[model samples]
Each structure stands twice: as C-alpha cells, then as structure tokens.
Target: MSHSAIRRVPASVQSLRSRAVWLLLALVLAVAADAPSAASQAQAPATADDLKQVQQMIDKGHTDEALKRLDELAVTQPVVPGVHRLQGQAYYAANRFSDADSAFAAALVQDPHDLESTQMRGLTLFRMGKPAEAIPLLTAAHNWGPQTRVDPSYVLALCYLDTRRYDDARHSFALQYGFPPDSASSYLLAARMLFRRDFVPVAKDFAEKALALDPQLPLVHQLLGEIALAGNHLDEAIAEFEKERARNPLDGAVYDRLGDAYSRAGNYQPALESLQRAVLLEPYNSAPYILLGKVLLRQQVPANAAMYLEHAVGMDPGNYMAHSLLGQAYRSLGRTSDASRETQTAEKLQADTEPKLQNVK
Candidate 1:
C-alpha cells in the first residue's frame, strides 16, 4: 500500500546519463556569453574547472563553501550559464529553499532548456509550498528523459497530490514506481487512488484487474471489500474482507472493515466480536471503538454503548459519527442535556466535513 519509495533505473542507464552530463556542460559553456548585457560581455566566462570545484564541494557536503565560491563567481561571472544552476544546487543542499528558487530562476533565464535547473526550481517551489507552480516545471523536466537521480516524476506525483489531481497523481506515481503497463501492482495502485476520489466503477475495474493478475496479492481483496462496502453490497464486502483477513490476520484495519460489513448486514454478534478484535489489535485507533458503540446501541445495550462511544469521542473529538452515536446513547440513558450537546457538536462537525468530502469526490 505504501507507494512513496521511487524505483531507480538500471545502473547502466544511470551511467549513460552521467556520461551525458559532460556534453550538457559543454553546451552550457558554449552559451555562457550569449547574454546581451555589457556587464556580462566585460567579464570572463566561468571555466569548467570552476564549475567542477563547486560541484565537488557540494558532493562533499560543503554547501557553505560552495555557496561562497558561487557568490564570488556571481560577482565576476554574473551571467555565466551554469553558475546559477550550481548555486541553486548548493542552496538546495543547504535547505535555503527561497534562495535556491531564485538561483534556479536565473539559470532558467540563462538557458530555458536547462533540465537540471528546471527540476531543481520545481523541487524548490514545492518545498516553498507552491505546488501549482511546481507541477508544470516538473512535468517539463520529466519529459526531458533518462531521469536518474532526483526523480522528477516522483516529485511531480507529489505535486499532483498536493493540488488534489488524484488521477494525475495515481498515473504519475505508477510511472515513477516503474510499474509495467499490465502490472498487477499498477492496477491495484490505480484502484486505491481512484477509490480515494470516489470513482467507484473505475476503481472496481482496476481492482478486478489486479485480482485477475494475482488473486493472493496483498491489499487487493481489502480494496475490493472497501468498494463493496461503499456500494452497500454487504455480502460481497463481507466475503472480500474475510478473504483479506485470511491473508492478513494481523491487520487491524481488515478487522475494523469486516466489523463494519457485518454490522451493516445486521449480524451484530459477529460484528461485535470482529470490532472487539480490531480494538484489541489497534487500541489507539478510534474507528473500532466507534463501530463497537454503534453495534452495542443496535443491540439495545446503551450503558455499554456509552462507554465505547465516550472512548471513541475522547480519542477523536472531531468524528461526527462518533459524536452522533454518543448522542443516541445519551438519549437512551435519559441524559437529555448531554444528548443535546453531543447532537449540536455532531451537526457542526458534519457540516464542516461535508464540503471537504464533496471537494475530494
């Protein structure tokens, strides 16, 4: 389920890209003096040695020293094609995000096609909380080919997530993870992302594709279970969840989900047992507690329901469902004032979350 780790290309491909850097460096040097300014024309161009020294400093974790050298170079070689790019690299290494952004901007101004500068600038903008600006730049850099180090595709996926472009985020993540076209993992990942955006039908198709490829794939059954639960297909959801539980008995989330499915099917005793197991497995999670309270209430055990509901609300005060269930318990116990208060809080939380849920969908 965790897709954050980016897969690296083969070492030979990386070696080839490394060799191409020299050619890129040469091209940058050839255009160093192309700036149409008297100051740039008066100054000597930065030598390959100068660029190499800064790179070596950065490589050695001497970003401060690299920045100092870059500052000196900027004074005399203000418009040098690759100097700002190197400066940006050093600044980024030092975690000076805004400074890095400015340096990369200068590098892009010098050479619009500078891939390294564009990628660095996009990453810098992302770090500075400007994902909208970062996306296009990252997309452009990713299109330049053979992304070895600092994968632009991974960063672009993150940018898409930040901007709430779920489909783009899923596609970018699949690409960055190096999933093959018909890979089971790719389909599963797509299903998960689509499910988050509430694209149920498409998500179900991808999930089914993953199952067709490998029936025993971890989390695939769980995903299908969740989709069925969302659609109120209680029997199908319970079956899928049971399949997932057989594969991963230790996963508290599966137990919690199974409990929900059983509860929706009006199988309270099994639901209670499953929910209690979920709570035992993940004591810190409020979800099982909330479900346990609701099931207890359904069985007309308000006293026990109130205890679980109180624990759930204590753990996650902002949970509207938990608050609402606690209110029902309070009403059953004839605590009118407490029930009124809980109902008001639940109403407010529901109103607040509805817009966010709508936006996500």
Candidate 2:
C-alpha cells in the first residue's frame, strides 16, 4: 500500500500492459514523445533547456508547473518553435481539451509541417468528442515524417466508426494492422477490435457479416460466442461455442471457453468434461487446470482440487485466482498453515497486479 513500494507486475498483467500501451501511447504519450529532441531543434540555447525542463514537469504530472514555465517561455519568444506544442501537452495532461486543441492549432499555424502538433490537434478534438472534425488532421498526420511513436490510424479508425463510415473504419483499421480490407478476415479483425473497445453490439454485427461472407471461417463463431459470453448471454454463448466446436474440433481454446460457459451455467459435469478435454488439448496453458480445480472444489473434492490447483500454481505462479483457489482447497483439507500462506500469496499477487491492470485506462 505504500506509494514508494517497489512495484512488481505479474507476467499476465505485463502482456495486458503491452497491448494497452500501444493504443494508449498513441492517444496519451504521443504528445510527450521525444521532447528533448524536439526542444533541441530551433530554439534559443537557454530556451532549449527550459523546454526540456518543462516537458519533464509535464511528464511528471506537474502540468500546472509546466504550463507556468511555458508561459515564461512565451514571454521570451511568443513564436518559439515547439512552445505551443508543449503548452498543448500541458493543457492535455491537465484535462483542458479545448485549450489543448487551440494550443495545438496555434502550433500547426506556426509550422504546418509540425506533425506532432497536427496529430495532437486531431487527438484533442477526438478527446473533446469532435471525431468528425478530427478526421482530416488524423489522416494527414498518421503517416507524417518523423513518424509517430504509435500509429494514429488506430484513432482514425475509431473516428470513422463513430461517424458511421464503416467502410472507411474497416479500411483504416486494416491498414493499421496490415489486414486485407475486403476479406472476411478483415471484418473478423474489426469485430475483435471493436469487441475489446466495448463496441459489443457493433462487434456482433461485424462478426455476423464475417460469417455471412464465409460461414466456415475459423474463429468467427468463437468470436461471436465470446461477445455473447461477455454480454452474459450464457445460452447464446453455449450455442455459438457448440457451433465453433463443430467447425474447429482441434481448437483447444473453444473447449476452454465452452468449459467456462458450462461452469458459469452450473453444469458442473459437462464443465468437467470440457475442461478435461481442454487440459489435454492445451497442455501449455494453466487456465483449464485452474478451472478444473474450481470444478472439483465445487463438487467438494478438495484432494483432487488441491492437486489440479497445485499444478496450476506451478504453471502460473502469479495467477491470483489459482492461488486463491488453492487456499480454498487447503482450508477444506484442514491444512491451516498452508491455507494461510496461499491466502497471503493470493492477496499479495492481487494487490501487486491491481495497479498495472488499472493502466488499461
């Protein structure tokens, strides 16, 4: 709980962070990118260091201080290159979207080739819910020189999706990820992306479209089932997962998801069967092992549950769910000391991973 504690992230959470940061670095950290170099280019020698310090301030969450320093810089050179961009960043970090948009616009006006300014202007507009107004700038800046740290095409696709430009959205998304825009796989990719972004209803439509184009497309039914499962439509999820099973019998993931759906529906026997199949098919993953342990625990077979859980914990030591379930199994078996240790480990793992998981925002 201490602020200065040495933080450690679980491997699972690290994977999530890497995925989220790609999208996030574009939307948030893009403004803060390469500040030292940007400052070194075209400025009074004194102002160069000043800009660096101000950017450091902004990066440290001291936006107010950064803005005040930028104000002093403005007084020295009202037209100083990169000053407005820094101001825009400070405003952005401070949640002053309108001010950020104006500052980035001023930076663009001063130097039309300021790719950072152009990209930030578009992003600020998007943050302000002006997706339509953001398209042109985002489109132009997505491929600008001194290329952005992450593709701006990600947001451009979202903007297109928001404005009901499905074709454009799909095209931009495919371009960002190198998928063929007209293929069934493209729509499937869009649906997966949209599903993760919480555009679930729209995601379902795309998934359906993918199926329409190619009924036997791999994972399309699985994606549909995943959407239904997320929406808590258990029967629908089971139906879709069954359809997926019919199409791709060798996919261990389908069995894993089907087992999860069955477990959630309290059909423990089938859940056990499906999870056991998943365990055989996906030997490298610990998910089915953990789920199998839970099903055993639910059936009051603590000894068996403990065996599976121990295997799961060994496979993924940082998995708090596995640790917590192992604690339950130990408690049921009256291994008081062992139960207490696992409970403590589960708590520690959960606490350690919470902050990293929050980084998804």
Candidate 3:
C-alpha cells in the first residue's frame, strides 16, 4: 500500500460493532464528559457568543486564553456556578490537577449543592493520584448524584479501584458492565482491572463472558490471550487470537494482539508478519510499529527493525516504550549517537500513568 493512500475503512467501525454486542449482553456503557466542565460567569448575563468563543478556544487547545476570559467574567459575576464549573473542566483537560480542584471548589463555594462541580472535583483529585481524599467527595456525589443528573457510580468505581476495594470494584463493573458488557473498551477496562487485582479466575471468566457476547470485539481476545499466556498456555492463546482474526479480517488491533501471542509462542516469523500487517493498517498508531520492530529485532533484522522503530517514535513523541525500543534498535544497528539520544528521550518521557500494582491476569 502507498504511504499516502487513504483506506476506505472507518476509523473505529469494529469498536462500534462491539458496542452493539454489549447491548445484547445487557451491559450499560457510561457516556459522559464529551467535553470538560467550564465555569459560567459572564459580566453581562452570559450571551451565546461568549459560550461559542469559549468552546472555540477549547477546541483549539488554547486553555490559558479561555481561562483568562472566564476569570474576567467571574470577577463581576461571582454568583454563577457554571463559570467555575467550566473553569475546573478546562483545567482538568489540560492536566492541571490543582487548578482544576480549586476551580471546582470555588464553584461549590458559590453553590454548595452543585453536584456537577462536586463530582468533577472528585474526579480531578482521583486523576491527581489522591483517590483516598477523593473517596468521601465521590461518595457524597454518588449519594446525591441521581437527584442532580449525575451517576455517582462512575466516580465510585474508580475510587474503589484506588482504595484496593476489589469487591466494590467488581460490583461496580457488574452494574455498568451489565449495561455495556460487549463493548470492547468497557470489557478491556474490566479485564485489566480484574487482572490487576489478581482476581485471575474471575478475570478469565469475565473475558470469556465478554467474548461470548461479542466475538469480534477488538480487544476481547487479546485479554483472553494474555490470560492464557500468563497461565503458560501459549498455543491456546495464539489459537484464540487467530480465531479473532478470522472473525474480523480487517481489524488491525486484533492482528497486533495475535502477533504478541505468536511472539510469546516463539514463532518469530509469523509474529513479524502479523505485526507488519498491523503497522500497515494503522500507520498513525505507534503500538503496532513498536511491536513489529521488536519482532524484527528479535529475528536479527536490524535495518528492518530500525525503520519500524523510527516510525513508532514519530507517531507518538511521548511514548516512552517506543523510544526505549527504538534505542535498542539503534544499538543493534551500531548507531551509538541515535541510541544515546533515544534512551535520553525515553527517560525524559517516563511518567507514571498506570495507577497501581494490580495482578492483571
């Protein structure tokens, strides 16, 4: 395929199909926060134009500029909770945790009964690695949320995960997953969480349930494959992923996962082929490239590995795994300078995104 050629495939069609399957399984998918919260203060009774302007700024990722306008509005109209709420949302989207918490607090100060702001504040604290502090806030929100058009259960589940309350997390998943079990993304999260908590038996059981509900789910087989691999059943895992590929021939994500399974089985040649296909299908995504590069490097194909590794770094500048793999590729190719640079970049990009140690199957 030509590099510039545009594939006719929709970006997330398989994912969409998976959602349909989830409905059949009685799993509910939570859909909230298409956009972050924003404060609603405007000096002059809040015109539509001001809202449009703020939205435009947000779309452009000009958060600071948007906040400046919101700040001006708040000074003259401190009574509006919407302004403070939106400000908190904007800060959260920018990953400014402290600023988001303060904005939400200010909104709550204006109206103690603002459930939206309270839930958002709890979420901000959770994201900031302070789930212990978030527990009470989220509990309060959950208790009063339905009355105020909020689902406290969503926040509650995350809080439970942070506090290592496995039973609570399981209950939360049972409730929400019942709403949307077949959804690939939802099941993936449940499987990951369950596996992290060392609930191996349940994780496998849930993976099987999710697969039965949605055979073509993008990531469902992958989780099953991982579970099997962890149990030393490499051939079973590979066969499972192969079955998934047969069910959805055009799914690049499935191919990448199958490739991982093949690698674990020590089938380097097939692993290289599957991962290469995945890279071709989703060139803009860094994961397949990284995996393909690893497979090639394992086979001692240094030049081929370097090309894929370079592409991975180009696609995701902040992906530490990509940089680390690229560094290894460079070293294999005897490029000392490139290797050193890549290693440095990987180190600089390393930050904790994974919440905690949970034994994901």
- Model 3 has an lDDT value of 0.75
Candidate 2 residue lDDT tens string, 199-235: 8888999999989999989999999999999988999
Model 2 earns a TM-score of 0.69
Report the error of model 1 at residue 129, Å.
16
Error of 1 at 292 (Å): 1.0
Candidate 3 total steric clashes: 27
Which candidate gets the maximum lDDT versus the true structure?
2
Which residue runs of candidate 1 sit more than 4 Å off their true CA positions?
1-109, 113-140, 143-171, 178-181, 354-361
**For every model shown, what is its TM-score relative to the native structure?**
0.60, 0.69, 0.54
By TM-score, the best candidate is: 2
How many backbone clashes can be found in candidate 1?
0
User: TM-score order of candidates, best first?
Assistant: 2, 1, 3
The digit string of per-residue lDDT tens for model 1 on 73-113 reads: 88773456788989999888888898899999988988998
Q: What is the lDDT of candidate 2?
A: 0.89
Off by over 4 Å in 3: 1-112, 120-153, 163-189, 192-202, 212-218, 229-233, 317-361
Question: What residue pairs clash in candidate 1, if any at all?
Answer: none
